[model samples]
Target: DAGITQSPRYKITETGRQVTLMCHQTWSHSYMFWYRQDLGHGLRLIYYSAAADITDKGEVPDGYVVSRSKTENFPLTLESATRSQTSVYFCASSPVAGTEAFFGQGTRLTVV
Candidate 1:
């Protein structure tokens, strides 16, 4: 099937360590977003790219770095993993703004 996929579905890392979560979509959607799902915050956007090479910070972008050099790939990197960063990260893609978005299974990341 053609859809979005996230690598390392589950990851455990130590504090202060840097980790990168990979996300890829086959649809070549125009909008791709990275969101961290936390208990109280629900789904908070970390970063989003409107198109290849066009990126912007969302609600919570601190300690996170995102790049989209290709329409099919959007990778998010944690500069330094922290205990508070432990959450399920989701990658989503939409053909355009205000449209239905398809999400990946998500990557469960834990920081010790």
Candidate 2:
């Protein structure tokens, strides 16, 4: 089974537009996370979910929102896309907190 999956591996959007990225995992892991990677900022956690219906903001959660309605699916939405938000997004899942996480290939989003 596929461990993790992210949709639209690459995307290009205009500024001020709304965009949504989809993530899915097959392991039914207890923890799921959203992260954004940039040159200077490296990778920063955006949001995470401990389990279904449980979510929390991460270090860089201001411009993004995430929800986990089911253990296998976690989707992230960018309310108003910005050039600053242009980066690689990754979805990861782990069986326990602080444990090894399995990540998707990553989605590269470009906001013009």
Which candidate number maximizes lDDT? 1
Backbone clash tally for model 1? Answer: 0
**Model 2 lDDT tens row, 24-44:** 999989999999999888889
What is candidate 1's lDDT per residue for 3-100, written digit by digit as tens? 99999899999999999999999998999999999987799999999999999999999999999999999999999999999999999999999998
Residue 78, model 1, lDDT? 98
The 0-to-1 C-alpha lDDT of every candidate, in the order given, reads 0.96, 0.94
Error of 1 at 12 (Å): 0.1
Candidate 2 ranges beyond 4 A from true positions: none
Question: Which 10-residue window in model 2 sums to the lowest lDDT?
Answer: 61-70
Best by TM-score: 1
